[model samples]
Target: MLPLTLRFSLLALSCMLPLAALAETPLSTERVTELETLLYQDCGSCHGMTLRGGLGPALPESRMNAYSRDGLAALILDGVKGTAMPGWDGLLTEQEARWIADHLQNDNPLDE
Candidate 1:
């Protein structure tokens, strides 16, 4: 039988493997659009039609996209400190936030 320490180590390593795989996978554009539409209809009620900022801060010009996917995921999970941006961890998943980050990084269609 394996020693207790070795057994625990193997268990931990095995648990982390799936998390690492999940971290590497990115959301698809179609999922991104679906999330965007949800954001527009729900969060957009205050954030603006284009997320150009309204009652809430503008997201398009924000440097949010420059941050790592994990960073954006945290923001979505843990709302902006003292801001109107509510924590969306309950409403959205990390994958969805990553999708939002990807979409926000692109040039606005109106700017073209």
Candidate 2:
């Protein structure tokens, strides 16, 4: 039989596994790359290739400060009413929207 300390260690690892999995980003690496592509190629068309603004408003951190994380995610999914921004809910999942919002909010680099 395993030693008491080893058993305890195994139990601890088992308990943490589910939480670690749960905390993981819902999008897989491949999916994230694809979404980034869409975010840059399609979304950038209006928001600007550099996200500095063109047809749409600038998405830099200063301009994005007005939105909360959840609010940004909702906007990404539902879009602004009576505006050029089209809802991506038809194309992307809620998790994907939230991920994109976080990526933007944190000023993380997106593929150009």
Candidate 3:
């Protein structure tokens, strides 16, 4: 069995490896700002200003925990067919979509 420190290090690396692979190019401050606004003003229209619940379902951790980050990103970029959600694939990269997926579940600060 590995020591706790070694195990923790491996676990952290495992978790990060996928994201590191997914997002090769870091989001610039301008792009990040644009996405932030879309997330709030656009997505918020349905997901709720506080991401609680509205025309769309609530996006709290409890709800988001049901899906993996990759799955969530796909859903965001590809959109849910037969639903109100429209695909953003033409407008956003997979990396940006993945960033949004991770952000939504993590309660990222909107002010930055």
* Candidate closest to the true structure, highest lDDT: 2
Q: Candidate 2, 89: how far from true, in Å? A: 0.3
Clashing pairs in 3: none
lDDT of all predictions: 0.72, 0.83, 0.82
Q: Please write out the lDDT profile of model 2 over residues 1-112, one tens digit for every residue.
A: 9999999999999999999977845678899999888887888899887787789876886556568988998999999889999999999888898888888878545322
Residue 3 of model 1 has an lDDT of 100
Model 2 regions more than 4 Å off: 1-25, 109-112
Ranking by lDDT: 2, 3, 1
Name the regions of candidate 3 deviating beyond 4 angstroms: 1-23, 108-112
Q: Candidate 2: lDDT over CA atoms? A: 0.83
Q: At residue 14, what lDDT does model 3 achieve?
A: 100
Clashing residue pairs found in predicted model 2? none
lDDT of model 1 at position 94? 73
Q: Give per-residue CA lDDT, model 3, range 73-95, as digits (tens).
A: 99999889999888989988888
lDDT of 1: 0.72
Q: What is the C-alpha RMSD of each candidate to the true structure, in Å?
A: 5.4, 5.2, 8.5
